[model samples]
Target: MLTNRRSTMPMKHVRMPSWHAGSKTTTSALPTYTIDNTPKSLTPAILTSTTQSLPGYTTTRLIGAIHGTASLTHKVPKSFMKSLSGSFTGSWGEPKPLTQVLYQARDQAIERMTKDAIEKGANAVIGLQIRETEVMGCIVVSVSATACLVEKERRGVKRDSAQENPF
Candidate 1:
Protein backbone atom coordinates (compact mmCIF):
# COMPACT_ATOMS: atom_id res chain seq x y z
CA MET A 1 0.00 0.00 0.00
CA LEU A 2 1.13 3.54 -0.78
CA THR A 3 0.02 6.96 0.55
CA ASN A 4 0.25 10.38 -1.11
CA ARG A 5 1.56 13.39 0.80
CA ARG A 6 1.72 17.11 0.07
CA SER A 7 4.17 19.79 1.32
CA THR A 8 3.38 23.54 1.69
CA MET A 9 5.78 26.16 0.34
CA PRO A 10 5.78 29.97 0.30
CA MET A 11 6.74 32.09 -2.71
CA LYS A 12 9.09 35.07 -2.40
CA HIS A 13 9.05 38.28 -4.48
CA VAL A 14 12.15 39.02 -6.51
CA ARG A 15 13.40 42.55 -7.05
CA MET A 16 14.78 43.97 -10.28
CA PRO A 17 18.21 45.60 -10.51
CA SER A 18 18.43 49.34 -9.82
CA TRP A 19 19.31 50.13 -13.42
CA HIS A 20 16.04 48.70 -14.76
CA ALA A 21 13.87 50.16 -12.03
CA GLY A 22 12.54 52.79 -14.40
CA SER A 23 12.34 51.97 -18.07
CA LYS A 24 9.97 52.37 -21.02
CA THR A 25 9.94 49.79 -23.79
CA THR A 26 7.64 51.49 -26.27
CA THR A 27 9.43 53.08 -29.21
CA SER A 28 8.84 56.85 -29.13
CA ALA A 29 5.42 58.16 -30.13
CA LEU A 30 6.85 60.18 -33.00
CA PRO A 31 4.86 60.07 -36.22
CA THR A 32 6.16 57.46 -38.60
CA TYR A 33 4.97 59.31 -41.68
CA THR A 34 7.56 60.86 -43.99
CA ILE A 35 7.08 64.31 -45.49
CA ASP A 36 8.82 63.82 -48.84
CA ASN A 37 9.06 60.47 -50.52
CA THR A 38 12.29 61.49 -52.22
CA PRO A 39 15.50 61.08 -50.30
CA LYS A 40 17.55 64.20 -49.63
CA SER A 41 21.29 64.78 -49.32
CA LEU A 42 22.68 64.69 -45.79
CA THR A 43 25.71 66.32 -44.18
CA PRO A 44 27.42 65.67 -40.86
CA ALA A 45 28.21 68.89 -39.03
CA ILE A 46 29.12 68.54 -35.31
CA LEU A 47 28.25 64.90 -34.91
CA THR A 48 31.67 63.56 -34.08
CA SER A 49 31.79 60.11 -32.51
CA THR A 50 33.77 61.48 -29.55
CA THR A 51 31.27 64.28 -28.85
CA GLN A 52 30.46 63.13 -25.30
CA SER A 53 31.38 66.63 -24.19
CA LEU A 54 33.00 69.81 -25.47
CA PRO A 55 36.76 69.66 -25.17
CA GLY A 56 38.30 71.77 -22.37
CA TYR A 57 34.86 72.35 -20.84
CA THR A 58 32.49 70.71 -18.40
CA THR A 59 28.71 70.78 -18.29
CA THR A 60 27.20 73.14 -15.71
CA ARG A 61 23.45 73.09 -16.16
CA LEU A 62 21.52 70.47 -18.07
CA ILE A 63 18.98 72.24 -20.24
CA GLY A 64 17.18 69.02 -21.01
CA ALA A 65 17.37 65.84 -23.01
CA ILE A 66 17.01 66.68 -26.69
CA HIS A 67 16.10 64.30 -29.48
CA GLY A 68 15.97 64.34 -33.30
CA THR A 69 15.05 61.66 -35.79
CA ALA A 70 15.12 61.20 -39.59
CA SER A 71 13.97 58.56 -42.00
CA LEU A 72 15.16 57.98 -45.56
CA THR A 73 14.40 55.39 -48.16
CA HIS A 74 16.97 53.63 -50.25
CA LYS A 75 17.92 55.93 -53.11
CA VAL A 76 17.55 53.22 -55.67
CA PRO A 77 19.06 54.30 -58.95
CA LYS A 78 16.63 55.36 -61.67
CA SER A 79 17.24 52.07 -63.38
CA PHE A 80 16.37 50.07 -60.29
CA MET A 81 13.48 52.30 -59.25
CA LYS A 82 11.90 51.77 -62.66
CA SER A 83 12.12 48.02 -62.23
CA LEU A 84 10.69 48.21 -58.68
CA SER A 85 7.91 50.56 -59.81
CA GLY A 86 8.45 53.91 -58.08
CA SER A 87 9.25 53.91 -54.33
CA PHE A 88 9.62 50.67 -52.47
CA THR A 89 6.17 49.26 -51.72
CA GLY A 90 6.99 46.51 -49.23
CA SER A 91 9.61 44.96 -47.00
CA TRP A 92 12.42 43.36 -48.95
CA GLY A 93 16.10 42.64 -48.96
CA GLU A 94 18.45 45.63 -49.06
CA PRO A 95 21.36 46.28 -51.41
CA LYS A 96 24.83 46.81 -49.99
CA PRO A 97 25.12 50.07 -51.95
CA LEU A 98 22.37 51.51 -49.75
CA THR A 99 24.74 51.62 -46.75
CA GLN A 100 25.93 55.10 -47.69
CA VAL A 101 22.37 56.33 -47.87
CA LEU A 102 21.72 54.96 -44.39
CA TYR A 103 24.75 56.85 -43.10
CA GLN A 104 23.43 60.03 -44.67
CA ALA A 105 20.16 59.61 -42.85
CA ARG A 106 21.97 59.08 -39.53
CA ASP A 107 23.98 62.24 -40.11
CA GLN A 108 20.80 64.19 -40.86
CA ALA A 109 19.35 63.13 -37.54
CA ILE A 110 22.50 64.34 -35.75
CA GLU A 111 22.32 67.64 -37.64
CA ARG A 112 18.81 68.23 -36.39
CA MET A 113 19.86 67.46 -32.82
CA THR A 114 22.79 69.87 -33.07
CA LYS A 115 20.46 72.58 -34.35
CA ASP A 116 18.11 72.01 -31.43
CA ALA A 117 20.96 72.28 -28.97
CA ILE A 118 22.10 75.58 -30.49
CA GLU A 119 18.58 76.98 -30.39
CA LYS A 120 18.39 76.18 -26.68
CA GLY A 121 21.50 78.32 -26.09
CA ALA A 122 23.60 75.25 -25.51
CA ASN A 123 27.19 75.51 -26.64
CA ALA A 124 27.46 71.75 -26.93
CA VAL A 125 25.60 68.53 -26.30
CA ILE A 126 26.84 65.77 -24.05
CA GLY A 127 26.24 62.00 -23.99
CA LEU A 128 25.03 62.12 -27.57
CA GLN A 129 24.12 58.79 -29.13
CA ILE A 130 22.73 57.64 -32.47
CA ARG A 131 20.54 54.66 -33.21
CA GLU A 132 19.18 53.25 -36.48
CA THR A 133 16.72 50.66 -37.69
CA GLU A 134 15.38 49.35 -40.96
CA VAL A 135 11.66 49.62 -41.58
CA MET A 136 9.99 48.74 -44.84
CA GLY A 137 13.21 49.43 -46.78
CA CYS A 138 13.52 52.82 -45.08
CA ILE A 139 16.38 53.62 -42.74
CA VAL A 140 15.31 55.48 -39.63
CA VAL A 141 17.85 57.25 -37.47
CA SER A 142 17.45 58.89 -34.06
CA VAL A 143 19.82 61.19 -32.17
CA SER A 144 19.57 61.83 -28.47
CA ALA A 145 21.61 63.99 -26.07
CA THR A 146 21.57 66.30 -23.12
CA ALA A 147 21.72 69.93 -24.12
CA CYS A 148 24.12 71.70 -21.79
CA LEU A 149 25.83 75.03 -21.29
CA VAL A 150 29.39 74.27 -20.39
CA GLU A 151 31.97 76.71 -19.04
CA LYS A 152 35.67 76.18 -19.34
CA GLU A 153 36.89 75.86 -15.78
CA ARG A 154 40.39 77.05 -14.87
CA ARG A 155 42.74 74.11 -14.77
CA GLY A 156 44.38 75.34 -11.57
CA VAL A 157 41.11 75.71 -9.67
CA LYS A 158 39.78 72.45 -8.28
CA ARG A 159 36.15 71.50 -8.29
CA ASP A 160 34.21 72.26 -5.08
CA SER A 161 32.84 68.74 -4.83
CA ALA A 162 35.57 67.81 -2.35
CA GLN A 163 34.73 68.29 1.31
CA GLU A 164 38.35 68.86 2.32
CA ASN A 165 41.47 69.59 0.28
CA PRO A 166 44.18 66.98 0.54
CA PHE A 167 46.95 69.55 0.27
Candidate 2:
Protein backbone atom coordinates (compact mmCIF):
# COMPACT_ATOMS: atom_id res chain seq x y z
CA MET A 1 0.00 0.00 0.00
CA LEU A 2 1.16 3.61 -0.75
CA THR A 3 0.63 6.72 1.43
CA ASN A 4 0.03 10.36 0.22
CA ARG A 5 1.96 13.35 1.70
CA ARG A 6 0.91 17.03 1.90
CA SER A 7 2.88 20.21 2.81
CA THR A 8 1.50 22.76 5.30
CA MET A 9 3.66 25.71 4.01
CA PRO A 10 2.89 27.89 0.96
CA MET A 11 5.20 28.02 -2.09
CA LYS A 12 7.55 30.97 -2.59
CA HIS A 13 7.45 33.25 -5.67
CA VAL A 14 10.38 33.08 -8.13
CA ARG A 15 11.65 36.20 -9.89
CA MET A 16 11.74 36.37 -13.69
CA PRO A 17 15.04 36.67 -15.59
CA SER A 18 16.06 40.14 -16.75
CA TRP A 19 17.19 40.93 -20.30
CA HIS A 20 19.59 43.65 -19.10
CA ALA A 21 21.57 41.12 -17.09
CA GLY A 22 22.01 38.70 -19.99
CA SER A 23 24.93 38.97 -22.40
CA LYS A 24 22.85 37.68 -25.30
CA THR A 25 20.69 40.78 -25.20
CA THR A 26 21.88 44.13 -26.51
CA THR A 27 21.59 47.48 -24.73
CA SER A 28 20.37 50.70 -26.34
CA ALA A 29 22.99 52.94 -24.72
CA LEU A 30 25.62 53.10 -27.46
CA PRO A 31 28.45 55.62 -26.86
CA THR A 32 28.73 57.73 -30.01
CA TYR A 33 26.76 57.84 -33.24
CA THR A 34 28.84 58.06 -36.40
CA ILE A 35 28.57 61.17 -38.54
CA ASP A 36 30.61 60.94 -41.71
CA ASN A 37 32.86 63.96 -42.24
CA THR A 38 34.22 62.75 -45.58
CA PRO A 39 33.71 65.20 -48.41
CA LYS A 40 30.99 64.37 -50.93
CA SER A 41 33.47 63.95 -53.76
CA LEU A 42 36.01 62.03 -51.68
CA THR A 43 35.71 58.35 -50.86
CA PRO A 44 37.62 56.91 -47.95
CA ALA A 45 39.66 53.80 -48.83
CA ILE A 46 41.23 51.18 -46.65
CA LEU A 47 45.00 50.88 -47.12
CA THR A 48 46.11 47.27 -47.07
CA SER A 49 49.20 46.16 -45.16
CA THR A 50 50.59 44.23 -48.13
CA THR A 51 50.85 47.53 -50.03
CA GLN A 52 53.43 48.75 -47.48
CA SER A 53 56.06 46.31 -48.84
CA LEU A 54 57.55 48.00 -51.88
CA PRO A 55 58.79 45.81 -54.74
CA GLY A 56 62.60 45.27 -54.75
CA TYR A 57 63.07 47.53 -51.69
CA THR A 58 63.01 47.13 -47.91
CA THR A 59 61.39 50.07 -46.12
CA THR A 60 60.55 51.53 -42.70
CA ARG A 61 57.22 53.32 -42.23
CA LEU A 62 56.46 56.41 -40.11
CA ILE A 63 53.69 58.89 -39.56
CA GLY A 64 54.42 62.59 -40.00
CA ALA A 65 51.38 64.22 -38.28
CA ILE A 66 47.76 63.72 -37.26
CA HIS A 67 44.96 66.29 -37.43
CA GLY A 68 41.36 66.03 -36.20
CA THR A 69 38.20 68.06 -35.49
CA ALA A 70 34.90 67.52 -33.64
CA SER A 71 31.67 69.50 -33.54
CA LEU A 72 28.35 68.77 -31.72
CA THR A 73 24.94 70.37 -31.16
CA HIS A 74 22.97 69.93 -27.99
CA LYS A 75 19.47 68.65 -28.77
CA VAL A 76 18.33 68.62 -25.13
CA PRO A 77 16.51 65.28 -25.13
CA LYS A 78 12.97 65.26 -23.76
CA SER A 79 14.05 63.00 -20.90
CA PHE A 80 16.83 65.42 -19.95
CA MET A 81 14.48 68.36 -20.18
CA LYS A 82 12.02 66.63 -17.90
CA SER A 83 14.72 66.17 -15.25
CA LEU A 84 15.92 69.78 -15.53
CA SER A 85 13.14 71.15 -13.26
CA GLY A 86 14.04 68.59 -10.62
CA SER A 87 17.79 67.75 -10.53
CA PHE A 88 19.41 69.99 -13.14
CA THR A 89 20.14 73.62 -12.27
CA GLY A 90 20.57 76.00 -15.20
CA SER A 91 18.81 78.39 -17.60
CA TRP A 92 15.17 77.34 -18.14
CA GLY A 93 15.29 76.43 -21.86
CA GLU A 94 18.99 76.14 -22.47
CA PRO A 95 20.43 73.27 -24.50
CA LYS A 96 22.72 70.61 -23.11
CA PRO A 97 26.31 71.58 -22.23
CA LEU A 98 28.46 71.84 -25.35
CA THR A 99 31.79 71.28 -23.64
CA GLN A 100 31.07 67.80 -22.34
CA VAL A 101 29.49 66.54 -25.58
CA LEU A 102 32.21 68.05 -27.73
CA TYR A 103 34.93 66.52 -25.57
CA GLN A 104 33.48 63.02 -25.92
CA ALA A 105 33.14 63.45 -29.67
CA ARG A 106 36.68 64.73 -30.02
CA ASP A 107 38.15 61.85 -28.07
CA GLN A 108 36.22 59.23 -30.01
CA ALA A 109 37.19 60.77 -33.34
CA ILE A 110 40.86 60.81 -32.42
CA GLU A 111 40.79 57.19 -31.33
CA ARG A 112 39.20 56.12 -34.59
CA MET A 113 41.79 58.04 -36.61
CA THR A 114 44.69 56.57 -34.67
CA LYS A 115 43.41 53.04 -35.10
CA ASP A 116 42.97 53.58 -38.84
CA ALA A 117 46.52 54.87 -39.19
CA ILE A 118 47.89 51.89 -37.29
CA GLU A 119 45.96 49.51 -39.52
CA LYS A 120 47.52 51.21 -42.54
CA GLY A 121 51.06 50.32 -41.33
CA ALA A 122 51.88 53.62 -39.68
CA ASN A 123 54.50 53.37 -36.94
CA ALA A 124 53.98 56.71 -35.23
CA VAL A 125 51.81 59.81 -35.39
CA ILE A 126 53.10 63.32 -34.59
CA GLY A 127 51.89 66.92 -34.44
CA LEU A 128 48.20 66.12 -33.96
CA GLN A 129 45.66 68.88 -34.65
CA ILE A 130 41.91 68.84 -33.90
CA ARG A 131 39.04 71.06 -35.02
CA GLU A 132 35.28 71.18 -34.27
CA THR A 133 32.21 72.89 -35.69
CA GLU A 134 28.44 72.93 -35.21
CA VAL A 135 26.03 73.37 -38.11
CA MET A 136 22.23 73.07 -38.36
CA GLY A 137 21.84 71.32 -35.03
CA CYS A 138 24.40 68.66 -35.95
CA ILE A 139 27.99 68.05 -34.89
CA VAL A 140 30.83 67.57 -37.37
CA VAL A 141 34.26 66.14 -36.58
CA SER A 142 37.26 65.77 -38.89
CA VAL A 143 40.63 64.02 -38.51
CA SER A 144 43.59 63.61 -40.84
CA ALA A 145 47.06 62.02 -40.72
CA THR A 146 50.17 62.28 -42.87
CA ALA A 147 52.00 59.01 -43.55
CA CYS A 148 55.55 58.40 -44.82
CA LEU A 149 57.61 55.45 -46.08
CA VAL A 150 61.32 55.18 -45.33
CA GLU A 151 64.02 52.71 -46.35
CA LYS A 152 67.31 51.61 -44.72
CA GLU A 153 70.42 50.61 -46.67
CA ARG A 154 71.60 46.99 -46.31
CA ARG A 155 75.33 46.37 -45.62
CA GLY A 156 77.14 44.27 -48.24
CA VAL A 157 79.63 41.49 -47.34
CA LYS A 158 83.32 42.52 -47.32
CA ARG A 159 85.50 41.24 -50.22
CA ASP A 160 88.25 40.15 -47.74
CA SER A 161 86.02 37.28 -46.49
CA ALA A 162 86.65 35.37 -49.77
CA GLN A 163 90.45 35.14 -48.99
CA GLU A 164 89.83 33.18 -45.72
CA ASN A 165 89.69 29.34 -45.96
CA PRO A 166 88.14 26.91 -43.46
CA PHE A 167 90.02 23.64 -42.45
State each model's CA lDDT, in order: 0.64, 0.49
Clashes of each: 0, 6
Deviation (Å) of 10 in candidate 2: 29
Model 2 over residues 43-101: C-alpha lDDT tens digits? 22333131434443333556555444556656655543453444346545432333334
TM of each candidate vs. truth: 0.52, 0.40
* Candidate 2 pairs with clashing backbones: 68-130, 68-131, 69-131, 69-142, 70-131, 70-132
TM-score, prediction 2: 0.40
TM-score winner: 1
Residue 33: error of model 1 in Å?
Answer: 30
Give the per-residue lDDT digits (tens) of candidate 1, residues 25-86.
Answer: 33221112236534445644542334666777766777888888999766544554453443
Candidate 2 stretches greater than 4 Å from native: 1-60, 63-76, 81-97, 147-167
lDDT of 1: 0.64
